[model samples]
Target: MSRFALFLALPLLFHVGCGAESGDEDVDPLAGIQIIGDDLSDIPLRGASAAQVARFKEGDRLFDFVFRERDGLGPLYIRASCAGCHEGAARGPGAVQKMVLVEADGVTPAADQAALPYGNTMRPYGVGGATTLVQPEDDLVLKLSQRLGPPVFGRGYMEAVDDAEIERVAAEQAARGDAIRGRINRVVFHSKKNADEAFHRFSEGDENLIGRFGFKARVATLDDFTADAYQGDMGITSPLRPSELPNPDGLTDDAKPGEDVDVETVNAVADYMRLLEIPKRAPADPRGEALFVEADCAACHVPSLRTRADYPIAQLADIDAPVYTDFLLHDLGPDLADGLIDESASSTSWRTAPLIGMRHSTSYLHDGRARTIEQAILLHDGPGSEAAGSVAAFRALPREEREALIDFVRSL
Candidate 1:
């Protein structure tokens, strides 16, 4: 049966007399629905051993390797190392970068608005001894912007998730009607090889596909994203991305041939992330779980997805993914627009982030603008406006209930 149909078939009154029943009388509504202990337990990736751990350490060393002016660091890059942006607090693979704004000349627009000659993510540090000024023939001109962002953690399980499951979640949400539509955000896959010579274009056939990672759902795979970080963040080159950045400006020498970096390093980092377990749930989390569904947060943050058994990792093999998300991009309204549109997503659209391990996350929202969970809840609008309304009802509940809900999120 469809998930929405099953949800509708279940009695909402199950919570009323659930705990009062004797063993022989009514079935516990929370029985099968109870948060599974296995969900919070650490699950390692397949074939991971002490040797793998040693290799991962080697990958960490590679991650910290700094590029010199001769090695080609960045003509346009963000940070010097992945750890620089990804470290601190239970950091996730998805980290945000910050930069300052200077002056620029590009497409003319309204005030409080200007276009960067290249794109967002202004690099604060450039290769040593390079001139900071843009050449006269450059496409556009802009200065730096202020710093913004922090790193997040736990990404390997995210990549291990079967694409079918993400589609299933979206199907389940759509079946619930337009009141809670969750659309998947299609993203570019950097590692995908173009069959045709259309590598630069954005097309469904361009080897690019739906995005499962990033706040905006931009990247396709952990490997692809890590490789991008190697080049864009650290100014390193690999086989998949061989061209070296030019000296001084750190611009890529497009005219030159590319080189290959060690694949083992990239693989180890991906393995480390894939095996990283989700945070454990708190004792009070069950109450929070009940409140999460009752509050309609599950409308978008729908939980309990079954993963494909064929996944490489034995721990994630044929398991139920308790990660709370529909994996869909929805309009967040003008209040949160980044003025950038990717593939199928609009300027105001953002992927519904998985709420797993949300308890460890302090800053909320895509831009990390909301300081607390409550503020994040309040910032919802558009398709998620109903969820925001649900939060309001949740707040009206007894203080203990609110605490339970918070506790549940921490447990995940």
Candidate 2:
């Protein structure tokens, strides 16, 4: 059968069963069931050759690279290395950081927003001298702050996800008349060429795209994000990003002129992240799986999505992807909005984070505010309020059942 046909028939075959009555006996809705066929945890990392491994080792090295005053590790920046922010067990992309700002400027740190109530993961390293390098004439005084985040794992498949599948899931949600709606976060592909140039040239009328990376979904691709991190996070400058983050505050000589880092190093780090394998699931997570589905979490946290036939990776080719996400942005209600708007996402809208490595994560939510999975589940609201209700129903289940749901998440 055609893939489209199969999708069209799913609602009929898997009817939305009636919600259990308030005090009914608990039933296992997903017993002996197998829905998705793809295994995202098994894909191999490219560039693992001996030399590649050597470079990967260097990239993984905690913080040996040096920065110069001109090369931009900040008049103001965040952590010194990717490892600094993303460290520790159970640390994935949803890491948290805390920073305090006493005054306001044109750009407010993401954590400082009164509405958001989270902390900013500020850069620990600086350039020039660690004090204000701004001309004596300028009257801007900003304080240095600190915040931290967890490590990100199993992200390659997340990037490998086909855009079309995300759209299909959104269409399905709209068709079902469910309150939950997921939207893709559009991002700018700065290097994307337009048709007029030997490569394509971008014109004024061309539609600006949505970013699919970062906490706010501001970056587009892993390569771009890596380059950005080199410049913004670590104070390194590459060919792609020639300028350094300005250092109005002269904290170290590293921020002085003519300080540039090698681009190949940055690429190597990105390659390591891209090739890092997804963690495997454990055997004890079946009950959790059942509860996950029964709680209607499957509506947004889709279990399987098939990759398109024409992708570069041979392993990912024609496989059923079980990353457990629809990859669409949804309005998470007033409580979650950051007041910062992107092209396709509103302040309240956030991408449905892929749950490929949830078991390995300590923090939850975009800002990493929820310390536990249960807290994160309870925080769901707005379009996802229905799913939240379903979760509450699952909580009412016997402790074993609840544990099963958590086990299932850990298994993933």
**Cα lDDT listed for each candidate:** 0.54, 0.52
TM-score of each: 0.71, 0.67
Give the CA lDDT, 0 to 100, for residue 130 in model 2. Answer: 57
Across 1-412, the per-residue lDDT of candidate 1 in tens digits comes to: 1212212211321222222113223243222112345452223333556555444444444444444445555544445455444432143223333221233322122244333344344343455444432222344332211222233344655665677888887787778744667687776555533212211233233443668666667776666667767766655666545655444444554222354355556666555555556666556656777788888888777686676676666667677776677667876665565545556676557777687666556677765566777677767854444354665767787988887876676666
lDDT for predicted candidate 1 compared with the true structure: 0.54
- Tell how far residue 253 is off in model 2, in angstroms: 10
Q: Give me the runs in candidate 2 sitting further than 4 Å from their true place.
A: 1-58, 62-72, 88-125, 130-150, 191-210, 246-259, 308-310, 382-389, 392-398
lDDT of 2 by residue, 37-94 (tens): 4433222244345544443344444222333345455555544445444542124321
Worst 10 residues of 2 by lDDT: 13-22
Score candidate 1 by TM-score against the native: 0.71
